[model samples]
Each structure stands twice: as structure tokens, then as C-alpha cells.
Target: MMKINQHILDFAKVFIAINLCLVIYSFAFESMHWLLNTQVAFFSSLFITIASFLSYKRNIQSRISNLDMSKTSKTEDRDKIDEIDDPYDLYTEYEEIPEEELTPEKIKEIINDEKSKVRKDSFKNTLFSAGGFLSIYRVLGYGSLLFGFFALNNNGIFLPIAFMIGLGVVPLGVLASKLLFKKL
Candidate 1:
């Protein structure tokens, strides 16, 4: 899909840009240790962020699909209205459930139903689900980042400032990609 391709392109751009800088630094300053330190930190963080993004994207897509499947006659009416004033449906749609029919018990029932759904979708329950926050890949990503950081520090190869900079590469890459690829 286009989304997957875009992610790959962004990743490639970021990876190349950061490593290119490191390559030049290694040649000019002749400090391979700095390059190694930065690389480990950058890579581990990249793993974590990318895994998190994929999980989140999958979660959103599933929710959208569920919504699409549950469309009803009421929603169909709204679709006709949306074609008039708000052609794109850019504004939030209000429910047709009238205020007069909203009795105390009805409100309570609605609230309870929503609460139950929230409980079902809670982070703890979804931790290892397909689109979960703590899915296996994400857990591994976090583990790699944590262990990599500790290993670097324990071995006394920790260049504190450089390591921090390396950790920032992904975010910087995201920004750069957005700027460079923005549609006019």
C-alpha cells in the first residue's frame, strides 16, 4: 500500500541521512567508538518508535473498519445531509437521540455500555493483541533499547551527549521527511 511505501521511504531517508553524517564524522575525527555508540542508540530507538507506529496504525485501521461495518439507516440519512452544507463532513456529527427521550435510566445505560466497552479495550487486555501497545514486537523493541543503553553504559563506551543525540534521530527524521515531502 501507499502508506507502507511512505513509511519505507521515510525510514530510508532518515537512516541514510544520519549514517551519512556519522560516516563523515568517523573519517574526519577517526573516533569509531563515537560512531558505534551513536549507532547502537539510534538503531534501538528506531526499533521502538517504528514498532509503536505500526501497532498504532493497525489499531486505528481496525477501529475504522468496525465503524464502517456498523453503519445504519440513521447514518445513511446523515450521509445525505452531509452532502448539502458540509460536503466533506468536516464537522462532527451530532446524534439524533433527542434530549426529551434521554431519561436518567437511559443515560445510565448508555454510560454503562460505554464503560464496559472501554474495559474490554483497555491497554492491559490489548497488550499482546495484534494492534496492542505491548505487542511482542513492541516489547522486543523496548527490550533492545533498554538493554542496548545499559550495555553501552556498563562497558564505559557511553558517550552521554552523543547517545542522546542519536536517540533524537528518528524524530528529526520524521520532521525532515514531512518537510521535504510536503504537498504544495
Candidate 2:
């Protein structure tokens, strides 16, 4: 059997639990419209969150695999827990160049190269990368949210409060999941 991802299982549990509560509320209130509106928003947000999560996970995996083995080995002696929690070190040491090599032209060239790299990395992270904000899945996700909201509202089936609650489900679920999964 193929192994299922634990994060996805957590999300599924969240989805089911929220909807089950809503179902009970719907039954008591006898308001199917509220249930429908909430479901649409909840499902759309959950879909988007899952897609972005998968994209981010893929990006991180690739980054890890592409890291220089020598650098990884140097950090291997540190606490294993810290490495697992944060693989990327936020502070990197800078190498110093001798004053003799710091000519105006050389300085200009170095600055330009750094600028270009920054621009390239920023552009890639903002749009071209799988986990970027403008990536296909993200775009689709927002589009679905907007269209779903308008569709339900236009049909006179929307409950603003219920829809808002539904939209909040993912963040709440994520928080709850983290708490549930936190290390002792």
C-alpha cells in the first residue's frame, strides 16, 4: 500500500470535524443554505492551503537535496532537533577580501553581481516558483474563493457570518493541528 502523507491526514481530519459540527448546527437550525455556503468557502480555502503546502514541501525537499554536502556535514554535530526544526541557517558568515583587490571597478562589478542575484531570486520567489504567491495553484485558489462567494451570494444563499467562519477554518485547523502535533 502507498503511504499517505501525515499532514494531509491531519487536514482531512480537520475538514471532517469542522463540517460535522456545521452539519449538526445546520440540523438544529434547519438552514441548508448556511451549510452550503460554509462548505464552499471551507473547501476552497482548504484546497488552496493544501496545494501551497505541497508546493512548499516540494521546494524545501529540492533545496535540501541541492545543498552542498560539505556544508551539511559541518553542521551535523549540532543538536539533531534544531537541525530537524530549522535546516536553513538564517545567519551566514561572510568572507573578507583584501584591500589590495578592492579596486573601484572590482567593487562595482561585485555590487552589480549581487544586485542581479537578488533581483533574480526575488522574482523567482514572488512568481515563478511552485510555492510563489502568483503560482497557478495560488491564483486558482483565490479565484475559486471569489467566484464561490459571489455565486452563493448572488443566489441569495449566503450567510455572511457562516461564510466568514468557513473561511477561517483552515487557519484554525492549522493551529489546532500544530498544537496536536507539538513535541512534548
Q: Pick the candidate with the highest lDDT.
A: 2
- List residue ranges in candidate 1 displaced over 4 A: 1-7, 68-73, 79-130
Cα lDDT, model 1, residue 144: 91
lDDT (10s digit) by residue, model 1, range 1-184: 3455765776677677876887688668857777777788788888888788788878777765755433323456566666566654557566678899999999999999999889876954465355657667799998998898899889888887778777887788777777877732
In model 2, state the lDDT of residue 76: 51
Q: Give candidate 2's total backbone clashes.
A: 0
> What alpha-carbon RMSD in Å does predicted model 2 have with respect to the real structure?
5.0
Q: Which ten residues in a row have the lowest lDDT in candidate 2?
A: 126-135
RMSD from true fold, candidate 1: 4.9
